[model samples]
Target: MAQITLVAAACVLVLSHSFLPGVKGTTFTIVNKCDYVVWPGILSNAGVPTLPTTGFTLQRGETKTINAPTSWGGRFWGRTHCSQDSAGKFSCLTGDCGSGKLECSGNGAAPPATLAEFTLDGAGGLDFFDVSLVDGYNVPMLVVPNGGTGQNCTYTGCVGDLNDSCPSELKVMNTDGGTGGVACKSACEAFRQPQYCCSGAYGTPDTCKPSSYSEVFKRACPRAYSYAYDDKTSTFTCAKADYTITFCPSPNTSQKSSQGQDTETTAATTSPLDFNSTMVYEGAFEESGASPSILAHVFRSHAIVGIVGITMAVRWIF
Candidate 1:
């Protein structure tokens, strides 16, 4: 009877492990398709265990992979035009984590930076994610699910280079005093108005409506978060999947749009690729063509067998 009890207990334990999503946790594959080098910064949410490395450098055409445990919540952004000073302090023009080192430690990206946010293993065991312009726009970014399923698991991002056409009032000029802009500041960051910032009496979603500035972003990246209240169009979810984050995803895409010399016209026609209104992820100019893995089918097959084993174990215990 003692030996039977031990066998039954072990069987149940082994079978239960199969129920967890991302059995080995999720893998975040960061790829750099931008022409210049990018120093990627990562910040885990408060109370969550930090990832192995908070920040790292990715040269043009380079790639890095990081594994995040189940239930991990955090945000990622690329630091552009980075330099290390004589004192060995590292910083960047855009998306700087303000840690003064390659590792962000625990600091979040500063405003006027593009961000990709994630909450893994949330309600219903789904992974929630979004590319947000609420802080502002610096670099073009895209988020693609590797092997995930859910109606909302499709691609989401602001792939347009908005800096070149950023409104003069909201433009963050290149420190080099070049004619071009490097980052586009959010209206909230630029004016600090209660309406733009969605603060004070305007804190509620009802009161805080989309301003004209946010509309510019919405027109460029329809699927991304344009403002504090853009949740309905921006947020996405998936279960049991890896992810690929690409900066400047399209090879043909340049920092400046190819739509002649008119900045306003270029801004309106951000990308040559047609955005599918359906939000179904179609192959892009440079998509990796990742499809949902057969693991889901394998999981279903094993699940049935595991359930039978668990039932037998319970009968034996009884």
Candidate 2:
């Protein structure tokens, strides 16, 4: 009796060990922390090629998570643009300038070029890490890593102006023989004409007053903002603001998958193992636990017998 019991226990142990799933990969959660919106992309270590599903919208203060295969060994980073629309929503406008046309001059219809690409090293997994969204004006906003975070892009100034152009231009309501037919010729003229003013102060004969619209326009556009990123200085400068893009090293064991979702675990990581060091184990049950151990063994022992039994069972059940 003792021998029989021992044999059965040993069989169960072997079955459990053989049937356990294995860890297949690691995952990462990217957080948006910049002031503007972001469109994230995964890149290789050489930065030569992009990985699958390279594009995703990340509004300011939002987060997203992705999974990578255990076989992948390349670095991962993100590229951001101001024009990325939220999911299920269409972009009112496209290109780097956000919603408005690139240029306000001459029909004003050229898209702006992408401002910059932010890169980060890809590891086996990451927790809720912060990724920033920066605007053309070089403003920094926040985003959480993965879908666990909420959308809360901060608008320090006015919104809905599109174009993302600061010192926003005042809309001219009426061009009734103003200095320029459609737009203002100079700052002085914009204020002098009431029809062009957004305040609607100049349009009516009774209120024909020269408003300060020109001054406001100058305050918004102001010589076209310039951005300077000095690698040597390790700093980014725009207008009157400066920031540093720094990395925070984390322990290898501190990493965790985003939201504990199985689907997301496979998106951010690489595919089909490559470099040895780059590979990571997700767990032990991921690969081996597809069916019951007894069924698997029975099928393995006699393929014909199992096939016949399975066919009969399926027929009867259906």
Candidate 3:
């Protein structure tokens, strides 16, 4: 009986480890705080494996969580005014992925879209992330790193709603000629000038200075990627952490909802992807001016080892 008990205890230890080793990936929780529905598109960096379900419809107030390899490098953006025809050809009026399907697969978002870009586990083991409007602007977005131990693991993004007052020359209007604007365009998108696009002779950062048009985006969103060379303050670094991406992340919205509340809406219904296959997660946080709390880890290895110890004691009785 003593020998049997020892064998069972060892088995329990092994089983516990099997259940815990699969949780090392970083988690991304995407929350939409806008008044309208948004279709989000994700694109992986070259040679990297694409995330599961590259595109999905996220209704207002809904949250989606995605687990990615610690070394994942990718960008995310929102597509507005999306629709599907009878053939299920999905497309968006702004920031379309051009896939003609709801799932973006490996497709990158078209220009004129606000981007949340990340490169995890890079040089010196630091994670770099930023909110880029260099491609253009379609919506206000923010990326907040949660629970990471590192210097300057703070939030990075654009909080301005540029569509409200986008310059007429750089505005992205609806085909219906609606009175209200839906998206904003970068000067490069509006005009193919090499200076604005940072191409030809202006390819280098020194020659590619911020133009008056880019300054408008900068003034509205100081921390965002206003132009191709807006890297001094736009880029942010951190250690390992879970990130939160929010669309239209106005502080007032968080104030009304009381800290990451989920008040579900409809017209377009979507649910979290399969947990077993995709392993995606969904969570939210209240908009806070205070520095992030909770040290940057979830289900630490020691915690799992503790579970193993507890299970071993139970199995010893067998």
Candidate 4:
């Protein structure tokens, strides 16, 4: 009986080892190298998110990190206003524009409001990341249609034709030989290229006619269309920009052991264990080694031996 109990205990220990949980660690580090300051945020697979504690102050080169959890994945993005001047208005002091000014060309205005979007994918895993400004100007624009109808158009359809007129706002202004309200007809004649001049009333030139604005916007803002930045090897010219994405693979925990040093391996390892698998093992062992039947047996045997020993002691004394 003693030997049987010892065997059972040894079995419990071996099984316990098999049931032990396997935890994985994942981490991500982001570096911001841009003139504009930013406060970055992070998202996770479980839908819980986090924001930077001190908020990143991107003056040129700065970095931060998010430590490991059960599983991790999401985007990192940020935005802030262009620095304002003493008069409490947006000012572009970074020399990002060609006219040595920060305001948009149309009546000292800025481009329509916009935001950046980024997407990331990993086959096995990824970690360690950096994003740098390719150029100084990463402003968002409200994409408008190509026609004279100033409705919101997709990025591809809004060739910077903010007003969505047949002759774009820019074309109309350039054609009228000035800015402001010049009639479409007169403006078309002034700005019409020889190839674009179809027999028309004025702004009705073939080139001035409505084409897809989305295509034009892509041509104009190819790099700015997406949220990516790369500082090295890319030109910072007005027409060219750059951004970057970097990551490291999460550690693998599914490796298997072989029989001997010279033994040949048979199969490839599987994906690292997940949080759900660990939870299942923990739940299975919640009442381990203390089943009701085992408890009752222990109590009954103790009671029977106590009663018999007590009776014998009393008779002997008498």
Best by TM-score: 1
- Each model's Cα RMSD: 7.0, 23.0, 12.1, 26.7
lDDT for 101 in candidate 3 is: 90
- Whole-structure CA lDDT of model 1: 0.81
Q: Per-residue lDDT tens digits of candidate 2, residues 118-162?
A: 232223222212221111222221111222212321111110111
Candidate 3 vs candidate 4: which has greater lDDT?
3
Query: What is the per-residue lDDT of model 3 for residues 1-318, given as tens digits with 9 covering 90 to 100?
Result: 787667667766655654464436667888887778999999999987677569998998898777776688999999989888988888898889899998888888887899999999898888899998888888868788887768778777775566756889888777745555677888898899999999999999989999999998787677788999899888988886788898876532212244455322110122211223221222334332221221123334445665776676667655
What C-alpha lDDT values do all the predictions have? 0.81, 0.29, 0.74, 0.28
Off by over 4 Å in 1: 1-22, 177-179, 251-267, 270-318
Using all chains and alpha carbons, the TM-scores for the candidates as numbered come to 0.78, 0.24, 0.73, 0.26
Q: lDDT tens string, model 1, 105-191? A: 999999899999999999999999999999999988889887789988887888777887788999998895555788999999999
How many collisions per candidate? 0, 43, 3, 20
lDDT of 3 at 111: 78
Worst-scoring 10-residue span by lDDT in model 3? 265-274
Candidate ranking under TM-score, highest first, comes to 1, 3, 4, 2
Candidate 1: residue pairs that collide? none
Residues 218-243, model 4: lDDT tens digits:
23334332111111211121111111
Which regions of candidate 2 fall more than 4 Å away from where they truly are? 1-20, 45-52, 84-318
